[model samples]
Target: MSTIARTPTDDATRADRTWTLDPDRALPADPAVRPIAREIYAETKALPLVSMHGHVPVEWFAEDRPFPNPADLIVVPDHYLVRMLVSQGVPNELLGVPAAPGSGVVAETDPRAIWRRFCAGWKHFRGTATRFWLETELVEIFGVTLRPAEDTADAIFDQVARAIADDAFRPRALLDRFDIEVLATTDPAWSTLEHHAALAADGYGDRVVPTFRPDPVVLLDSATWGQDVERLGEAAGEDVSSYRGYLAALRTQRLRFKAAGARATDHGHLATDTTPLTDAEAAGIYGAALAGTLGPGDADAFAGHMLFQMAAMSAEDGLVMQLHPGVLRDHDRGRHAVFGPDTGFDIPVVTEYTRALRPMLEAFGHHAGFRVVLFTVDEDAFSRELAPLAGVYPSVRLGAPWWFLDAPDAMRRFREAVTETAGFSNMSGFVDDTRAFCSIPARHDLARRVDAGYLARLVAEHRLDLDEALDTAVDLAYRLPLAAYATR
Candidate 1:
């Protein structure tokens, strides 16, 4: 920790601020293990980032424009920040959340006012990982030493704005500045990948790749399902009006995605069910869904069947499959009406994976060339189901603690739950799944510190030697994710 004092400012509230982000902030709190944890953290602190799975927009890189302002850059769009503020009774419109289709609403338009609101709410984020990421970006990336508070909000915003306007702080420049190795973006299956193709033609294909997200095209209950099918058909040049043609279109889309530097297929479904249906059964359901006459359970059944077929396709094509299921998006309908989706209203319910994924696992869990990485919002599944499943199935690996669980305590609990059963090798490494670009380094830095502390405890307990723990720390921070999404 540095003893550097805050720069002298006219704002009396922050004039004497001694807030500093300690290098070992998230390490083991126990003095006995701190040294070893520090040692392990030092070895990998400067390693390049591997964003094997993330939600950052590809247009940021393709257009390569300067970030608009501090509020949009940090405050308004991040769900974590928005959610915490809303929990404290702040209106969504105050933070600029966009309204849904039927609700007529206009959010706060003043950037400085939004920044003040966020800064005023900084204390609410105390002891949260969001605070860590925000503070790190302010101090480390923007070189702003002033603390975030009402008095210092404008000063800090101005400091960030100066950095934003600089040629050195542009999107592509920061990707290089942050030393990201390979950043994979989530894209729709029917996407033209125009931004990706542009980036590739600009000669950054190996650095920035796409992950095929087929949920929009396959999830039939949505009002836009017909349009999604039409888009898929257009992309694949196949008649997706029928089940056979739909499968062929999906296969063709996956091939296009792979050709454009994709190495993984991503699924964000409501459940982990991967049960397959007989060909006639699947065809009948698909026809009904298209004809708008499907039974209540038929859409879900067809989705599960599609997942089974997707596993089969992965087995054939060698692209890793990622399943992040069981999230209740837009939990509050009233809030959702005004905020649309992804405005920090998602909640996790109890999830069962063992029985849910049996059909798909039974079929392809033993496949030699296939691989699956599973993520959950349900932490109970970590020890009881996830680790045990990944332990036995050659195809399955446990993804990092994600969503609401991606915090210091949850990360420690994750290692404790999964390592004893599946061991470290069956784990996928850290992924900073954020649309907030600057938080990537902060999130990864936190993950490394947490993992280093976990490994240090193992070393101190004599469960692992110093060398092995160090190796495991590096693997968890860097190597494992690369191998998990490595090109076929």
Candidate 2:
């Protein structure tokens, strides 16, 4: 069997491979809206990026290393692109996924061949957000003018390889080029924050920060929970043998993360359930979790109670709390066992927040110092639950349409659904929420055009005047996220 994927025709020559992108691709097409959209996009398009939440590793900035190659830099570590290619029958091994941690299995396949395989299957991404981001990286970042295809893959790869060798294309240089003013990384409570310290020591502290994420400790059944708690104890220099000690240790870690420049805490779970247990109930569950004798429902009960605890802590410590729930992680058991978490199989499930979050919302909805930004993957919840929650709660802000729903059409739908209830001011603005570093600008650019188009439609409808539309567009793209995730 052949290793490379094949497209219908590989005969297209350089002259025939015309894939030029229009400067106004995602802008509004209606005559009434186009003018207004263009005006709004012009002002907000060049604003500095505030990446308040993302998965990009700080070590990339700390080490300031050159990206190894084109395929590794662009293809691997991106679940969106990998899932699409995998659906088309491409194996992860062929896509440069390391066979083992610190293993050189990726070197077994030639990088150029991997690029050709991806190019050959480029049709799989034709209308996807992945295509938009990849095309942007190719043309705008690497200066490549040709469309990806079997015929042009090698040439495009060579062009990108040359660009990667430039000192200007190194991680730090690209951070400046990307104009990333403030970037937040997802880190656990136990993280040494060594990379963050390194950047601060190097005078880059103002630019990059970590977000506290404590899922492992919160989820009772996570295989590493007991071990992670030990590490947390070590990090906090506090004993975690009792329920109160555990809480105190957690608080200690949160303070440490805040001192390390974390402005928010991120939580992801299988459900949106935020119900709180009474103190005695919570202490009993914590004891069971530590003893490894927790019942089937105990894990979820404990997790839900911890969500309330986290929000309470946020109120006390003044860190914005971010919740993105309703994902059934590692839907494919086989892939998860082999490749580990975030391996592109975390599928979305229907979740209810109105009843689930009542306990926490009732307690903290109007707390003076508390802020909760809620994100959802289920579109049905946007107007039905999330928007209405943000509409009334002084402490709540609607997170952007997240993960699976962050695409163009979904983004437009999000604006329409949530704006009527929460309005632009109650929205968290655009969050790339990405690990693919090169796609950050492209993601933000797409969000800006979508927001402009949404506002332009409002202007055309005369529901909003032109000047106000322009202001709302800029706030949605720039000001809102800055204010929402601001360090408290």
Candidate 3:
């Protein structure tokens, strides 16, 4: 490594002044490798985003309203930002995060105060992917050059507020500004998709679509399971007083999702188990669930059996199946009670996939109509299970490193782990996977840079030609997700 002598003045200047993002922020650090990485990155950087899987609210696009103040828009709702501060003993209420109904916690209502809290705790986000995305949003989207700190917080906030006040900053405007070709919002199976249909009527049907999420109904042990099941039956216009009716309701709902331009079905169960239950066993479990007297292990067994059934439904209906498992959501019971869900106490445990998914794979692995993209927070499953499974199964494709593992190094590790076995063809392109709308471009940019660096290393080692690497970068950045989640 070349030694570049630094002075104390440089350190002082960097510490206190406004900063600009480096053009080559996340490129490979190697002197020889970086230039190649930059070239690959430049080619893919401006490509229209293909967000085939995400959690952005459909109303944002449907209403097309200007976003709220900076804090409400960026600070309060982002679980990534909220969790880091909470980890440092900052109460969620102190950041304007509302308590659950009857939790009796009065949240901070002042947007500027919440923003200041975020800025004051900014150092806690150092070296995290959240920091990268936040910084990018601040500088690129809102045009804030000032660093996020206590002294600069108000200045930065004012700049962002002024920027978002423009008509150009509205949700639908940003969809075009962000060059988002296809944005998929996660929707419950019971949803009427009124917002999606509204967007469709406004001619955004092809660009903004919904992905069917059936977690609340499938994970049968939830306290609201009965109500959620009833809602599902109502949505599908099916009588779900029996197990067969429940199945029909789900199938009907999936078809409705497809009719609304949905291309995929999303599952976030705690495990990847997909063992099919016998007809009698499944019916008995359904009856118990309906009666609110389910036996031990019934919920887990039913969830698994439902996953198997989901694959069969996918085979018939052609909704790309997306599964990201092994998250223990709302890990802190007290925090969950106060904050409901997605205030981020989700933790990942060991997730086994080979045996867990064997039953589903055996039935649909070679089916032409079936496609499943497997994602996990457990990196151990990457090389050991995911790569090998995707290598052989035509229906299975490896999802991008997601959730807790979506950082730069983690993404690089994912590429290293699976590329050798499954190769690029069996990998789904990047998915932003955020509820934070402005962070979409930032997240996708980070993924592209990390991928560019990974491919540059391959090129530097003479394993992949520069031309081939360039094409693969475009595939990962633009084309792959389109193909992987294609409705047709």
Listed per model in order, the count of residue pairs whose N, CA or C atoms clash below 3 Å is 0, 0, 0
- Clashing pairs for model 1 are none
Task: Locate the minimum summed-lDDT window of 10 residues in model 3.
Answer: 1-10
Give one digit per residue, the lDDT tens place, for model 3 in 234-283: 99999999999999999999999999999999999999999999999999
Residues 288-406 of candidate 2 have per-residue lDDT tens digits of: 88887898799989999999999999999999999999999989876665566777388999989999989888999999889999999999998999899999998999988889888
TM-score winner among the candidates? 3
CA-lDDT, candidates in order:
0.88, 0.87, 0.91
lDDT of 1 by residue, 15-119 (tens): 457556777788998898999999999988999999988888999899999999998888876889989998998889888776665677778888989999999
The candidate that wins on lDDT is 3
Q: Rank the candidates by lDDT, best first.
A: 3, 1, 2
Which stretches of candidate 3 lie above 4 Å from their native place?
1-16
TM-score against truth, every candidate: 0.96, 0.95, 0.97
Q: What local lDDT does model 2 show for residue 68?
A: 88
TM-score of 3: 0.97
